[model samples]
Target: MLDIAKLARQMPEIGQQMQKDAQASVKRLEMAQQLFFQANEHQDNLIKAQELWCDRLIFSPGTPVESLDTAIDIPEAPPSHSVFSSDGSQIAPSHHEIIYCYLINIGRIMLHYGQNLHPLLDSIPEIYYKTEDLYGSRKWGIRTEEWMGYQRTLKEIQILTEMACTWVNPPGAHFNVPNLAMTDGSLAFWFLDTLPTEAREEILNPVIESWEQLRESKIPIVGYISASRSTEAISFLRLMACPYDVPNCNNYCSLDNEKNPCQKVEPLRDSSLWQKILQPRQRSAIFRSNSRILDFYPESQKTHFCYLHGGAEVARIEFPQWIAEDSELLNQALSITLTQIDKGFGYPVALAEAHNLAVVKGGDRTQFFSLIEDQMLRYGVRNVGVSYKEARKRGSIA
Candidate 1:
């Protein structure tokens, strides 16, 4: 427990420092806003700079697909539409546990508006304990926890894709309404960038296949990030502010020197920029992600994103290149997202419900381990025990 008296003694100093930081932040925001307009005015030059320095830049700058300064008003919501979302939670394999195993629980939700269709909510739990499942391929060298995270994301998208497919072609009948499929985070396979070609293919192949299925079904899918601190847009603005004609950061810019022209609008995020630019329910222009992992993705699956002012905060919404290029589909997706946020009170209802279902609480973890131990005992293997470190954590100590 914290000592209130000790904390109170330091509160004055902390408060003073916080005030100073707040003032500095305000100054940065003003300069950032100015730089933002300047970047917009010189948008063509900035785009040219990106083209020239594409291979040399250290940061991932977004490539604008539309006018850089434009903010489109939210499109009218459809009278009847469906939104499907899936989220997942995992109990990563732990060495301190009685058994080396993990559990993945996926929560899926489907909500139809103006159609009188009953909403669907379900959760699926799966366990991985086999040697092949736990360790994965020896060549990959990825930790079990990290591998499980990737697998969980894949399962979420796969399940969401399956849900959309079923809705699109349900039992000899075709239901045609504006449908949107959403996941909780980025769709990019960025984590696979460090892995070998074989490992990347092993992971990305299925994800791309799922994306293709959604595309074939003509269902628009998106990855929604709430209160995002991503700086891809800010990085683009920084590039626009670069003094070098060629803008070669490796040769020209130095982090040790605080005099870099691009550092003028330092310590700002994409969301902070959008919060100043976008009105409620409006969305910024779409920008293509420059993540290196996209080199492995097909043209159709390349990731694109835009910032949306969804009432409470700026949100980063990402989708595939195909969806971004299709104006009608993009508008439908934006409409669904804004409407859902309004209904859910600043968050999407489908995603909120899915998260509620996916979360594994403290009690759930305890019960999970107890069940494993119970099964081991049932098999007459009574030697099952947690690691000493885990046992100490559970017991009281003076």
Candidate 2:
């Protein structure tokens, strides 16, 4: 339980810290706004900023960045189109539960949009409890919640890939209609960055394979991130603030714990950078992600992103380079995304439905454990017991 009184006692200190932070943030915002208007003047600075961090591999330079002040109109949607989106939820391995099993539910939706909406497909939940499913004994020594979440993400991508393949090569009639495939978050697999090289490969191999299949199937795939705080693009502005040349800055920026000279834009986020430029129903220019993890993905599958402003906050939408390079494909993707947002009254309805189908509520988790206990008893296993704390909580009266 939380110590509310103790937390209350610290409120004064917390408030002071918050005020300091807010002041620093205000300074950063002022710097960003100044750069926003003078973006054309600092075009070369953005490029040099990327070059300075090029070796570090944390920055991906955006193209036509001189057009940062401009906003592109929302693209037109195809008359008839199909949209597929996938989302997943998982029940992490629990110590309090009788069984050591964990569950993952992946929800998929295929919606056809034209004159009116039509649900062409539904959600499918797949639960795995076998020893092989619970643990990654081959690579990981222990089963962890992080590993489970990674597996859940892999399944989500795999399902989206499978659906993309199926839709493109329908058993009877090919899906000639413009179709798009999307997942709920960033396409980059940043979660594996700290894992051992071999473990990262083991976890990402299937995901990469699925992505290859999806790309080969020619179905545009994108990852939708709402309220993104990514600063990849804004980091470019820091280069403009650098007092030295790009090469000199590179020399000064080293892995040997040298302080970066261009830390003036410390608190700026990408959405904030574009918020000053983009209007509702408009999108910013696409910029390729220079994430170090992109090295794991094939060159063709490198992710790129752009900021889109709906009636609400700026959203970052990531897609493979192939989709971004082709104008028609990019427009179709943008159109479908806007349509989804409109349908859901600000977000994608398909993803919303997929999340709804995949979410595992607290009550559902309780019933799941109860079912496990019942099955164990039915199998003549009587030693199963809940911890004392769990029992107390179960029996506690308000």
Name the candidate that leads on TM-score. Answer: 1
Q: Which pairs in model 1 have colliding backbones?
A: none
lDDT tens per residue, model 1, 62-160: 988888888999887888999999999989889999999999999999999899889899998999999988887555788778888878878998899
lDDT of the structure predicted as candidate 1: 0.89
**Model 2, 1-398: lDDT tens per residue?**
79899889999999999999988887888888786566556676566656656665333435443256667898768789888988989887777778777888888888886736557555565656786776654456535677777778888988888877876787796458888887889998877777788778877999889888877777888899998878877765655666665534435655454346666666578887778778888998777787778878887788888998876778999998777778788788888898888889999898899998888899988888888889899999998988788889899995
Worst 10 residues of 2 by lDDT: 57-66
Off by over 4 Å in 2: 1-27, 36-39, 42-49, 56-67, 115-122, 137-142, 247-260
- Score every model by TM-score: 0.95, 0.87
RMSD of each: 1.8, 3.3
Model 1 weakest lDDT span, ten residues long: 254-263
Question: Please, what is the whole-model Cα lDDT of each candidate in the order they appear?
Answer: 0.89, 0.77
TM-score of decoy 2: 0.87
Clashes of each: 0, 0
